[model samples]
Target: MTDENARHAEKMKKIKAARDRMMETKTEEKGLIMVHTGPGKGKSSSGFGMIMRCIAHGMPSAVVQFIKGNWDTGEKTFLRERFADEVRFFVSGEGFTWEVQDREKDIAAAKRGWEIAKEQILDPEIAFVLLDEINIALRYDYLDIDEVVEFLLYQKPRMTHVCLTGRNAKPELIEAADLVTEYTLVKHPFRDGVKAQKGVEF
Candidate 1:
């Protein structure tokens, strides 16, 4: 073989060995509290991706949408229609806070959503729970952050993976998360006068 090809092979061998060693160190496994937040999009989308993974494994999962109303979306429709037996979906919000324009109503909806989330989290049969857009409710003080965090960190089932998605996640929630991903908004189509497209923004 050429000298360049020989050098490339040598470098890959070292990388594989290092990766194997690092993977070996990761032996302990437990349910993870994951937070997906920031100004960018895809927070809820990413949470759904995890739910799809759970479905692929035949693991039962549940979703409690805290801020989005009963709007038609591809993920919602597909999951509910195709995987009804493995996924339990709930939409607890009437609409966005700006649209609802009633603090009392928003709070009531958030509380109702939280109750549903708690049920899913505590269910041993459920392996994954997605509390979609729950950070918005927490940000607006529609729900008690302390109570939510306490229950998630202490009272959740040992093998249940819970994901919280939205912007402006509480500091306490971030501190309690086992995995956190912040979606940075470098650019967006909305700013360019492009409306949200089906299968992309919904």
Candidate 2:
């Protein structure tokens, strides 16, 4: 073979070897915990997208809403109809903290919501659990950070994936997570008084 052809053949062999190694190391099924946090929109939306993907793959999922109580986004409504059995939503029912005007009440509602979220965590059959707005809950001391970390470490169910979404997620939660996504807010139309439109930011 020509020198140039020999080099190309050597590169092809290396590529095949790498591909074989990857295939050998690949797992058929695995579970992990992921956190999406930062001062940007679409955290919950991203979680919901993964939930849909899991549903497409016939995996069960559950969602627990911490801060959002009465604000039913379009995604929630759609999932209720399409993936009702695979999804669950636990709302605080207290609305926004400022709107509620009661710090203690917000914490109480958050604790109540965490009860349901914890239940979902223990469900081994549910392949995924999205803790929506949990960062804010932990930031405001609405949920116990140490307890949450312990649950993630020791109480995680077998073959269960978890996704926690909100701004400023707790450091402990990030440390315990297998994957973390921090969304940076550059600019949003909401700054220009644009309302959250359905099928977009809902």
Candidate 3:
């Protein structure tokens, strides 16, 4: 028993030393362009989680919802009401492609949304901006990817973090991003004839 305990203690000590050494090389403290893309859910949820963190730290946050109709989502309503002064929220999409059924209008909405999004992102006071479903817009070619990436490169503030969340993220946006996370769908109740619930799916 004594020998086993000593081995465990030595292993933990080595692990801690290695971890501390690796941490020493990480000296960056600036905003990041994070992308969350996949077929599964939780892309926007994770982006909203970042907004929650920003709000907790007393930093302002903005949300530009693209390719998603303005639903009465709990998070949206809560943030709009609770942090009215600290957050700016906008929904620029009428609905999904199947529902919208018009290419010209879709393009127009995307252009309008991107315009609003740029306004929020260029504001240095807002520490976090969630470009919800922006990837979908790019996938449909509703907005110019090169223009978006250029704006992100030259206009973003040093202390402002931007989160782009959706499926089918463009290659250019992913390459320009500082962090990328892909969520794989393993199982979902909707496949089993279950509808999207109020709190969970919405």
Candidate 4:
């Protein structure tokens, strides 16, 4: 063959091989639920780490701070300034359950926050959702486990990711989750009358 014809033939062979490889490789999308529980300080911290990882990969994330509505964590402030519209954070006006003791009011606040959570959980743009302290709310009967599970199963966008953190995680949640981490409390500063610090515990 002539030089021009030989060059064209080589280009055609390369194109054919590329087409075959593209046909052979395929990608499937799926979602995941990660639970961080047990009596420790890093449950929410772990969830936030996952959020940062997702964002680093150009994935959007949302955070729903349930029981810790009033207490301002550094993560919340950082997210507010950096991500702003990308992260959706909803905090109930009422603080902790022990402080409130108003069953009706606490439930009402949780339900409202859960409704907002439901929206964030289903949104396709929100690749990862940090449900900070959600397991504790479920354990305390502030939210319905079945309802949350059903929503996780049904409402999640294709390839969406979820992270839940709190203590005393129920068996059902553990079973439903793809990854579960239990942070055992071997040692903590709070036991020695150390109050929650600004950047650490808040």
Candidate 5:
């Protein structure tokens, strides 16, 4: 081989060795508590991606939508149609707070949503639980952060992974999560007077 080819192969050999060493160190397996929060979008989208992944892996999964109403979403439709048995989907919101316009009603919806989440999370058969838009509920005090954290600590199945998604996540919840992702807002079409598109926003 030429000198350039030989150097490229040597660099790749070292890279492979480093990657192997890193992979060798990740041997422990435990249920993960993930928080996806911030002002930007894609928080629920990312959690839905994981739900799809769980379905692909034949793991039972569930969704409890806290702040999103019974709007027809593409992900929900697809998951319910394709893998209905492995996925249990629930929508427990009347809409956004401004749209709902009733504090007590919103609180009731949040409580109902959380009750469903508690059921799915405690079910050992359900390996993944997506608490969709729950962060917004916590931010609005519709749900108690301390209570949620306590349940996650003591009630959730040991091997069940839980994902919370929405903006303004509570610091206590963030501290309790094993993984946290904050979606920073750089640019959004809504700021430019463009409405949410069919497949992109919903």
Candidate 6:
């Protein structure tokens, strides 16, 4: 082989060895509390991707949408249609706060959603639970943050993974999370007079 190819192979071999060593140290496996937050899009989308992964592995999963209305979303439709027995989906929001424009109603909706989420989280049959847009509810003080955090950290099943998705996640929730991802918005088509399109938004 050429000198360049020989060097490249040796470098890759070293990288693989280092990666294996690092992986060996990560032996503990437990359900994680994952948070997806920030101003950029794809927070809920990422949570849905994890739900898909759970479904692919034949694990039961549940979703409780806290802020998004019952608009027909692609992921929702596909999961319900294809994996009805394996997935439990609930749209618990009346609408977005700006659209609803009623503080009392919004609070009621959030509480109802939280009840549904709690039920799913505690279900022994469910291995994954996605609390979609729940951070927004907590941010607006529609739900008690302390109570939610306590239940998530202490009351949820030991092997059930929970994912919370929204823009402004609470500090306490972040501290309790095993994994946190924040999306940063560099640019968006909405700034360029583009409307929310099907299969992209919703």
What TM-score would every model get versus the actual structure? 0.97, 0.84, 0.94, 0.81, 0.93, 0.96
- Winner on TM-score between 4 and 6 is 6
lDDT of each: 0.92, 0.84, 0.89, 0.82, 0.91, 0.91
Residue pairs of candidate 2 with colliding backbone atoms: none
The candidate that achieves the highest TM-score relative to the unseen native structure? 1
Report RMSD for candidate 3.
Answer: 1.5
Please identify which of the two predictions, 3 or 4, would achieve the higher lDDT against the true structure: 3
Q: Candidate 2 vs candidate 3: which has greater TM-score?
A: 3
Residue-pair clashes per prediction, in order, are 0, 0, 0, 0, 0, 0
Q: In what order do the candidates fall by TM-score, top score first?
A: 1, 6, 3, 5, 2, 4
lDDT of each residue in 52-145, candidate 3, tens digit only: 8888889998998887765778777888898888788898888777787899999999899999998898887888899999888899899999
Instruction: Find the 10 residues in a row with the least total lDDT in model 6.
Output: 67-76
Candidate 2 residue runs with Cα over 4 Å from true position: 1-24
Q: Candidate 6, overall lDDT?
A: 0.91
* Tens-digit lDDT track of model 6 for 61-120: 999988876567888788889888989988888777898898998999999999999999
User: What does candidate 5's lDDT look like per residue over 42-115, in tens digits?
Assistant: 99999999998998899999999887775788887887788789899899997778887899999999999999
Candidate 2 local distance difference test against the native: 0.84
Off by over 4 Å in 3: 1-5
Instruction: For residue 42, give model 6's deviation from the true position in Å.
Output: 0.9
lDDT of 1 by residue, 1-202 (tens): 9999999999999999999999999999889999999999899999999888999899999999887775777887998899899999998998778987999999999999999999989988999999999999999999999999999989998888999999999999999999999999999988889998998888
Q: Better model by lDDT, 1 or 6?
A: 1
Q: Which candidate do you rate higher for TM-score, 1 or 5?
A: 1
Q: Pick the candidate with the highest lDDT.
A: 1
lDDT (Cα) of model 4 = 0.82
Candidate with the larger lDDT of 4 and 5: 5
Lowest summed lDDT across 10 adjacent residues in model 5 is found at: 67-76
Indicate the TM-score of model 3.
0.94
